[model samples]
Target: MTKAERALETRERILKAACEVIADIGFENVSMRKVAEHAGVSKALLHYHFDTREKLFAEAMTHSFAQTGTDLDGGDADVPAGVLLARIVRTMLPTDEELRQDWKLWQELWVRAQRDDAARHLAVDLYDQLHAWVGGAVERGVASGEFAPCDVAAISTLILALCDGLGIRVMLADPRVDLSTAQSTIWSAIAPSLGISPAFPET
Candidate 1:
């Protein structure tokens, strides 16, 4: 591999290991040495890339969430707004490996956010991104006459709140709720605003 490619690969490897370690233990207990050991790299090399555990934590949080399909702007540019909103819902489900990891990382972040200002700021920023993406989809749908007009800001925040609550339940493995139920509940709750059934419209 070229030097640049090799460097990127090493960084990804480290981040992956960091995610594993943080998911296994909370952020407060994660150490750079533990991450290095998990990555199977020399301490010096790990330090060369990430000088502190905080930096690694932040990057790992970004990496984990990225795997959750946060980029709603890409793919199937011609997709309808309702369809894109459903896609976002489906993506948030923790039914798969990457999403499961993302959910776990979110749990860790929540605990850390209570005690760490940086974690709190990061959580707020990430939620703002989600809100913006959902709001954009709502606005598009309204403009296209595919959805009824409503308060975009309130609706977006509601979607985020519902997702966060359901996601946490899923991550906790609550006996009362499964993926399908939580997902359906979210769509059902938001359906009145979107002018559609709770079930995802057949694509």
Candidate 2:
């Protein structure tokens, strides 16, 4: 690889190390030195890549989701719109091992969002991506006659809000909330909005 490519790889390594460190420990307990050690690099090199711990943590959140294939920026293009939507819902169930880690990382980011502008912006940006993903699927479904006419934007926002709320319940270990309940509730709630039966074959 060229020098530039090598540098990019090193930067990615540092970010992945930061994610692993934070995932292993709580975010509040993470340190740049710890991340550097985790990455097998020197503290100075870690600082060279990311000047502040907050910045590193913020970027790490993006890296973490991307690695898990849960960013949902461009889901399977070959699948039907409904199947793609169902796949998205399934990934967010938090029952899978990687997704469960994502939920824990998200919990930390959500708390940080309240006190940090950078964290808040990252959270908003991810949510917007999610909104677009759902909205695009709904539009495609309507155009293909798979769904009925409805307010696309409003339904998109509502779906996100509902998942966010229910996901929180699952994360909080609410006595009544489990992965199956969360997944089924969200699928049932959203399916009708698309003018389809409340059940879709699991992707």
Candidate 3:
């Protein structure tokens, strides 16, 4: 790889390490030294690449949701929008070992954001992406007559708030918080609000 590519890779490595450390521990407990150690890089190198811990954490949040970037940006909805929407809805449900780590990391970030402005900014960005995706879907649903003529923006914001709030609720509760059930419940609630039968499949 070229120098530029190598530098980018190293930067990503540091961010991932920082995210994992914060996930394993709490963000309040995280240190640049710890992240450097986790990345197997030197402290000087961490500072050289990111300059500050907040920047590293912010970049990590972006990297964490990189896979959803296209959809979150309101690009073309993935085919079979219902299935895609359902999949996105299920993002909060971490069933496997790997996903559980991602979930824990985000949970840590959320708690940290309560006090840290940088963390709060990251939280806002996350919700904004979800708003764009859900709002686009709602607009399309209205155009297709699948939903009643309603305020797409408001409904989208409501969906995001519900989804995000419920995720936090489940995270704090006992292990029995069934995310699948939560997804289903939200969908049912949304269907009626959009003037569709709960059983009606998306067009």
Candidate 4:
């Protein structure tokens, strides 16, 4: 591999490891040594990539938030309104290991942001981006007649807030609750407004 490629790979590995560590222990307790250990690299090497613990965490978290929001733009690309709304709804649940990490890390970041200006700014920015994206999907869906003529902004916020609350319930229960149940509940709650019935047959 080229030198640049190796550097990029190492950087990504460090960021990925930092994301998991922050989720596990949080920003206050997170240490450079711990991150290095988690990444399977020496402390010196970790420092070579990120001179300080704060830089390492901020960069990793920025990367994490990007994944959650950047795609939300949907780039004026023409997707079916219903499909877009469904996509927005689906991003909320944690269906895999990495997303689970992102979910936990987001909570940790929220608390850390309370006292740290930089973290706080990042946190608020991410939230606004997510809200706008979801709100846009709802608006488009309503305009396309995919949903009833209702208040899209309010409903989108309601849906986002519900997902947040449900996420907390899932984390507290943590694997004991089947995710399908939460997914179905969210779908059911919005289906009527979306002008569709739940896909599952009612007993």
After superposition on all C-alphas, the RMSD of every candidate to the true structure, in Å, is 1.9, 2.3, 3.3, 3.9
The number of residue pairs in model 1 that clash at the backbone is 0
Candidate 3 global TM-score: 0.81
Query: What is the clash count of model 3?
Result: 0
Could you give candidate 1's per-residue lDDT for residues 96-203 as a string of tens digits?
A: 877787787888888888999998999999888888878998898899988899899999999888888888888778988788888889889999987877786533
Write candidate 3's Cα lDDT for 111-174 as tens digits: 8799989788888888787688777767776776656888878877766766666666566665
Which is the leading candidate under lDDT? 1
Candidates 2 and 3, the one with greater lDDT: 2
Better of 1 and 2 by TM-score: 1
Residue-by-residue lDDT tens digits, candidate 4, 1-203? 99999988988888989998888888789899999899898899899999987778779888887776345436765776666666666567665676778888888877878888988988778777878888887788677776678877677777788778776777677664556666677778877776776652221
Q: List the residue pairs that clash in candidate 2.
A: none
Question: Candidate 2's residue-wise lDDT over 1-203, tens digit each?
Answer: 99999889999999878877787898999999999999999999999989998889888998876765453436455567777677677665566767777878888899999998989999999888878877887898788888888899988887777677888887778979887787778778877767787864566
For model 4, the local distance difference test gives 0.76
Number of backbone collisions per candidate, in order? Answer: 0, 0, 0, 0
lDDT of every model, 2 decimals? 0.85, 0.80, 0.71, 0.76
Q: Give candidate 3 regions above 4 Å deviation.
A: 68-78, 95-99, 173-176, 197-203
Instruction: List candidate 2 stretches off by more than 4 Å.
Output: 68-76
TM-score, predicted candidate 4 vs. hidden true structure? 0.78
Off by over 4 Å in 4: 68-79, 174-178, 198-203
